[model samples]
Target: MSSQPAIIVSSLDMDRIEALIEKMPRLTPEVEQLENELDRATIVAPEAIPANVVTMNSTVRFKFIGDDKVFEKTLVYPHDLKHDEQVSIFAPVGSALLGLAVGQSLNWPMPNSQSRTVEILEVLYQPERAGEYLR
Candidate 1:
C-alpha cells in the first residue's frame, strides 16, 4: 500500500512462481499483486540469495504490526498446501511475504478493506539457504 521495501528473490524460485502463475485458471487481484512483486524484485541465483530473505518453501516467523502474537508458517505452493500453517503464494499474506527479509514490514490490504502491517521477525528456514535449491 505504501512504497514497498526492496525485495530479493532467487532465480529458481522466480522461475517456479512464474510457471505457477501461468497455470492458474484465471487472473485475480492477488495474482496481479504477485506479478507486480515479481516485476520489481531483485532476482539472483538460488545459491546467492541472502540467508535472511524469504523464498519459496521458507518457514518464516512474522506478526501484525500491532499484534503481539507471532505466526510461524511455511510458504508453499497452492498444491503443497495441506496444513493450516502452510501459506500459498496466491494468498495475500503469502504474496506479501515473498522475497521479504527479516525486519522488513509491509502494509497488506485485507478483504474487508482494512490494512494490516506485517513484519518479518525471522526466517527460520529457507530452501536456498539450506542448499535445497531445487525444492
Candidate 2:
C-alpha cells in the first residue's frame, strides 16, 4: 500500500476508539489499521477540528476512482451502525475514511485481493461543525 496522508482526529473520538480496540480479544487487520491510524493522528479537541475533516457521526460523500458510483454514509461507532447508511469504524473503508478531508483519496484493501480507491467528495455534515461534539 502507498503512504497515507497525514490525518487529524478528535481527542474524544480517539479515546473512544482506543477503548473499543481494547475490548476486542483479537484484532482484525481493518481494526488494527484503525488503531495504527489513531496512533499517528494529530489529535485535537472536538471544537478545534476543521469543518471539512471527517469525524465520528460525520456524513461523508465519496466515490470510487474508476466507477461513477457515489456513496454517502455516516461514520459511526460500531454500536451505532444500523444499516448501509452507517459505517462502523471497525470496517476497512470506515478506517480509511476517518479524518480524511474533502478531495482526499485513500487506497483501501479489499477482501477480493485487490485495492480500491475512494476519494472524498464532500463532508456533508461533521459533528464538530454541527456542535454535536459529545455525540
Candidate 3:
C-alpha cells in the first residue's frame, strides 16, 4: 500500500458512509472522539464500476478527458482488492471518489484556479448492498 494519502471505503459510493463506519468495532468515548478526527484526514473510497469508476486505495480508475485513466497509483491499498478494480489508499482522486454515485461530477481544483471534472457513469459493486449482484 502506498503511503500516499487517499480514501478507503466500501460500497455506498456517493451516498452513505455508515457502511464502513459500522464495520469498525465500537470504541470508547475517547477513541470515538479520536475517530472523528481520523475521519477528517482519511478519504472515503467507493466500490468499482466497470466502464465508469473504481477506487482501490489511493489509486483511482475513471473516465476522464473523454477516456478511461488511472490517477495517482502510489496510494493503492495493501491486501487484496476485494473487487476487480484497484484503488490506492492514498491518491488525489481516490479520496474524492467515495460517497459519490453515477452521473454526479466534482470540479476539483488542481493548483491555481485550473480544475477538472469527474463524472460518475456507474457504480458496479457495493459489497454491502450488492449481495448476489456481485456475482
Q: Of the candidates shown, which would achieve the greatest TM-score relative to the real structure?
A: 1
What value of lDDT does candidate 2 attain over all alpha carbons?
0.88
Backbone clash total, candidate 1: 0
* Residue 114 miss distance in model 3 (angstroms): 5.6
CA lDDT of every candidate: 0.91, 0.88, 0.40
User: For residues 1-135, could you state the per-residue lDDT of candidate 1 as single tens digits?
Assistant: 248899999888889999988988898887887898899899999999999999999999999998999999999999999998999989899998999999999887766667788899999999888889778
Q: On residues 61-107, what C-alpha lDDT tens digit does candidate 2 reach at each position?
A: 99889999999999999899999999988888888889888988888
Which is the leading candidate under lDDT? 1
- For model 3 the local lDDT of residue 23 reads 59
Model 3, position 109, has a per-residue lDDT of 38
Error of 3 at 64 (Å): 2.5
Better candidate number, 1 or 3, judged by TM-score: 1
List candidate 3 segments past 4 Å from native: 1-61, 65-85, 110-114, 132-135
